[model samples]
Target chain A: MRFLTLVLRSLFRSKRRTFLTVLSLSVSVFLIALLQSLLGTMDALTTSTGSGTRFVVQDKASFTNVIPQAYTNFLRQQPEVERFTVLQWFGGEYKDPKNFFANFGVDPESYLQVYREEANLPSIPLEQVRDFLRDGNGCMVGRALADKFGWKVGDVVPLKSSIFNLTVRLNIRIIFAGLRKSDEMVLAFNIKQLQEAVPWMKGRVGAITVRAKNPADIPRLCERIDHHFANSAQETLSITENAFNLNMMKLLGDYSTMVHSISAAVLVAILIVTANTMAMAIRERTTQISTMRALGFRSGQILSLLMAEGLLLSLLGSGLGIALAMGVASAAAKVAGQIIPWMADFIITPETLLLCVLITLALGLLSTFIPAYRASRRPITEGLRAL
Target chain B: MDDVSVRLRNLAKSYWRGSLEIPVLTGIDLEIPRGGYYALMGPSGSGKTTLLNLIAGIDRPSGGELEVCGHSLNGLNDDELAGWRSRNVGFIFQNYNLVPVLNAYENVELPLLLQDLGRAERRERVLHALSLVNLTDRMRNYPRQLSGGQEQRVAIARAIVHDPELIVADEPTGALDAKNAEEALILLEHLNQELGKTIVLVTHDPKAASHARFQIHLEKGVLDRTVEVHDRPVLPRLLT
Candidate 1:
């Protein structure tokens, strides 16, 4: 305790320098936590919807490609496919070009039933759905996207399509905010509206998503779906949700490689910064450390005191950074909610928090190893003479 | 009762600066009896500090058997020697050697902290020791805030706080002004006469040496002469 008093006194003697070091540490940790949280939120969005029984049948060339609209009709005949729906990636923007959200042209009935667990689309009364679907351009929007623009049930919103140069006048009859993950500012307009709107709308649809009763039936169902479309002009590539997310991760330039490389850089930088602090503290305390030893404090006490200082500082810095991260993530969720509604689900799991703390302690240990050893093995006389 | 608190026979200390065998204490033979105040006076490089160091267990002898408080100086390890020194010998260096971070009270209480005493007991002992040096009022002041005399008194308080059998002072008054030096010398004499704590002090000032019940002067690593109170009248007599 007395040793800690000594350590604290020495550090606070130059209060500005210590505060600056702590501030630098906080900034470093805050940035690291922010980047990691973004990645974490992305992963959560991907993994939460993963089910082996559900396979997305998209064009082998690209996910955005339109298979013949006739293919969905042909694939419905397959016994292995329990239920299927077309997932159209309707690229559209709301308000200004800066405002972004996913708009998908989907088969509203089958899509809602298939992904009822993940749909953030509001539960419109069957009468309301019929009323909303009464017109071809009538759309059901995500409530989060609705709430973003202060939209209510009767708001007529203008959505401009990026893929097709058509301006969509969507009469928002009902908002379908179902699950937390799928809440976005997307308009699930009638496929007929999409077919009539686009120039290349001749018997074309985006993709078919198939769900089987048994997970074991997925691969055979996929093969069956592909076999049915084998003779068509457009071929199909069927992949499970996990595989789809994995492919998305791969789309970010090899998930394991990039995350590993970036993590290594971050960790190295943290180590260097923390070690520099320890070194400076040790340098200043050369005499006091010797004095402690001369006062019958064991070598272990000196080492423990130095390590404790490093650990305490780092833990506090990291702790504050993480707290700030949660706050920033929540505020960002409101802003990003317009674009990626699922981003609000950025979560810090216990495993992740434990990992963060472990990183802090590890950095503490790693940075202080040399400084503590150097301080401990130092001769009392020489250390005293240094001051 | 055995009066000898320290005994050194044929003690020699040498330093190897690169290639040179620079001998500091050459063949020193000395004895310090318990409860007696003694001063070791010498010029620079005359082995006064070296001999004091060996007696205090701060340094090891290069060649020869030296013993303090019945422990074989050659046999004890560094840690054991430190514990042994803590239990037996208190130290007052030229710079006082008080931990600058601690106030006078904390500094006085340091050595006793090594013991297994409770905080209240430690406080009592520390206060008692400070009272003997007449520094109880200055207990809260840090070393920097205290005058040289008071700092030395606090150092003295720290030394005797644990009630060690012997106190070793190395040029205790060297850094003090004449008044502070004389004040420190009076405290040392009081500690010896009243508390009966054995002190092996090293100094160069004749006035400081005169306060000791025994004075041993060294020249060129050799003990020149041992003088008693009756044999010296060169300075003010504390007893007179």
Candidate 2:
């Protein structure tokens, strides 16, 4: 503790160099934190416990291929299948193409039953839910979506579908709040209204969501469903909801690898910059180090002092980076929610923070070790004569 | 050996420049009794500073036996020698060598920290040492804030604060003005006589050498001769 002030004072001896090095380090750390948080958010979507008991059945060719509506009848007959819903991705634009949000056409009744945990209907009045279920043109917008567009219970929302090339006008009957902010970025309307209005979407849906009676039965149920559709013309791919989201992520093409690569590069750059800074600082202190040795301070003590200075510099930079990352993440959650609803839950987890801190510590030690050791081991007479 | 603060016999040191060995000191035999004050004087390449470093245990001799305060430095490892030096030898440098970031008190407190002394005892010793050099009022001032003379005084205080048995100085007043140099010399004399610390100083100045009880001159890598001073200057009683 007593040596802390000495270490700190020595670090700031060249204020401009120290400040620039720390700034560069903080920016790199911030970039790393954001990238790690993105990977974490994606992982959360595919591994969430809530998705364990649910299965998604899509056309075997691709998720974009529509599955026949008859698949829902086959799913209902299975004893392990507790409830199911037909979900169609209604890629629609509100007012402008830039104003985008997740809008899905779903069976109003079964959608509520299958996703009761996520939808959280208790927050809304009972009368609004009845109106939403009974009225063919009635739709339920999540609280976040509603707040974003200044939508009220009685407001009529006009959505122009990019896929169907049709415009549908519906009255909002329920404004639902979900357990998570990401869930509250969606808007669900009656699938029947979309089917009746569009000729191509009459007897097909993008996917079917099946809730299992027992989570333990999910694997068996998926295998049975896939087997049933094995020889059919439009074969189905039945997988857990988590695996379905993972498949969707895969369609985006090795993004995890890209993020990981970019993260590694950033770490290397920061390590080089920090190492150079520490080398310069140690080089300048050669004479002082010799004087300390002459005053009976051991080589190990000098090495430790130099290492402490490096560690403090890295930790302070990382701490500031983490704080900046949190603030940016909060703002990004709102902005990204409009473009990618799943990203609304983007957050820097404690584990990610802990991992970053550990990495920073390793970086500190690794960047300064060789230089500090070399400086400490230099000939005392030679160093004393350096000045 | 019991009465000697430093003893050297056939001590030698050499440096390697690629493939060639350039000897700095060779076949040197010397001794200084306890509480003795001596100055080493020579030309630029006389190796007086190198010899001082050897006696201070900061440098190892290439050959022969060297002992300071009764500790044989030949067989000790670097860390072991450091421990021995911490207990027995203090050092004053030409550049004042005080850590620029540390205040006067902290600089003096550094050597004590190497010992098992508690904070109060370290503070007491540092205060006494600073008072001996008459710089107690500048305890909180950093090295940059003090003049060249005052900075050397802080260096002197740092040297004596740990109460080592011997104090080795290399051109201690080389950077100071005439007035400051005289004051530093008087302080060195006080530490030698009053505190009973054996002092070995290396310098090129005749006036500084005249203040020592004896002067040892060195030629190229060898001891030339020794001269004893009969009328060393009497310092002011203020140091008492």
Candidate 3:
């Protein structure tokens, strides 16, 4: 404890050099935190959905291929299927093409039933649900989506779909709060409105999402649904919600590999830079170190002091860098969430934070060990002779 | 306490450069009794500093017996030597060697930090050391903030702060002006005569050596002469 003052004072001896080193470290650490968090968020997308009971039924050819709404008849026959909804993506823009968000044509009652837990349907007033079920033109907007567009109950929001040559004037019937962050960034309207507006879409939907009566029944239900449509004109593929999201990510190429590669490369670069800085710092203190040795500081003591300084430096930089990353991530989630609903799910989890801290400590020890050890072991007389 | 403060029996030291063995001091035998004030005088490469380092336990003899302050230095390892030095020896260098980042008081308190002392005791000793150097008012001044003479005085205080029995100074006033050098020499003289400290000084200046009771001269790593100064008078103590 008494030696702490000396170690601290030594660090500030060259203020500019120390500040620049810390700044560079902070920037590198910030980048690593953000990148790691991105990977962590993508991982959570597959792992952390509220319940494992939900699965999606899409065309085996590709999820982009539309399937017939008549498949709900077969789904109703299965006792393991509690409820199901026809969902179609309405690729729409509000006013300008830039003001994009996820809007879906869904059977309101069945959607409210199957997604009751995720969308917090029980929390909404009974009147809002009734209005959504009775009016084909009415819609239920998520809390975040309503707040983003300054929408409220009774506000008529118009959306123009680019895929289908039709426009929708949807009356906001309810604003629902969801358990997951991404769930609160969607607007689901009654599919009857889409079917009536676009005649050819009357019996078709992008996908059929089913909620299993029991979680243990999901695998069997998936097999039964796929087998029912095996020889039909449009074959069906049944997968859990998690596998669907994973497939979506796969379309963006091997992002996990690319992200990990970038992170590793950045880590190595920072390690080199930090090690070089530590070496230079120790080199500049050659004489003082010898004087300390002469004053009876043991070699191990000297090494410990230098290691503490290195740890403090790395911790300071990493702490600030992580805080910076959190702030940036929060701001990005809000801004990007308005344009893409999934961006709202972006988060830096506690596990990710712990991993970053561990990396910082490892970096500190690895960067300072060689230089501090060498300096401590140098012959005392040789160092004393240094000017 | 042993009557002899330092004893060397056929001490030899060598430096190795790759496969070459360069001898610095060869078969040197010397001793200084307790409370003796001796100056080592020699020209360049005469190994005066090397001998001083060996006596201070900062360096080891290649093949000889060396002892200081009753401890046989050759038997101790590097860490043990450092512990021995902290307890028995104080060192002053030509450049003062005060850590630039620490203030006068902090610098003086450095050696005491190695000991198991409480904060109050450490502070008391640091203040007393600074006061002895007549720099208590400048205790907060860093080395860079003080003059060369003041810095050397602070270094002197640091060396003596832990109350070691022997002080080894190598050209302690080499960087000082005449007035400052004389003042520093007088301080050393006071430390030897009034405080009963055994002092070993290494210097090239005759005037500095004259302040010591005896001068040991070396030529080419070998002792040439040892002379006792007869004309010098016992100086009055200049520090309280």
- Residue-level lDDT tens digits of model 1 in B98-208: 777689998898888778888899989998988888888989898889988898999888888888888888788989999898888877777777677888889888887
Q: Superposing all C-alpha atoms, what RMSD in Å does each candidate have to the true structure? A: 3.7, 2.7, 1.9
**lDDT of model 2 at residue A99?**
82
Error of 1 at A95 (Å): 3.1
Model 3 residue A213 CA deviation (Å) reads 4.1
In candidate 2 the C-alpha lDDT for residue B153 amounts to 96
lDDT of 3 by residue, B165-203 (tens): 899999998999999998899888888887788999999
True contacts kept of each: 0.16, 0.59, 0.71
DockQ of 3: 0.79
Q: Which stretches of candidate 3 lie over 4 Å from their true place?
A: A48-51, A213-224, B233-236
Q: Write the per-residue lDDT of candidate 1 for residues A1-387, one digit (tens) a residue.
A: 645665665555566766776666666666666667667766765665525567888887888678887777766777777778876776777778877777777776777666655663345567767766576667777767777788877778787877788777877776776556344446677677777767697568887777878889888877877776676777888888768877876777765566657867877887898798789878877876765565556677678877887777778767876787667877877766656656656555555566677777788889988998799778665675575
Per-residue alpha-carbon lDDT of model 2 for A1-387, expressed as tens digits?
Answer: 767778988999889998998888888889899999999898887876468889999999888999899888889899988999999999889999998988899999899888887788667789998999999889998888899899999999999997988888989999998887778888899988788988988898999999999999998888888999999999999889998989889888887998999999999999999999999899988988998888888999899999999999999888888988888988999898768888888998898898788888888999999999999999888999998
lDDT of 1 at A57: 87
Residue pairs with backbone atoms closer than 3 Å in model 3 (clashes): none
- For residues B52-160, write the lDDT of model 2, one tens digit per residue: 9999999999998998899899999989988888889888999998898899999999888889988898889999999998899999999989999999999999998
What is the DockQ for all candidates, taken in turn? 0.36, 0.66, 0.79
Worst 10 residues of 1 chain A by lDDT: A178-187
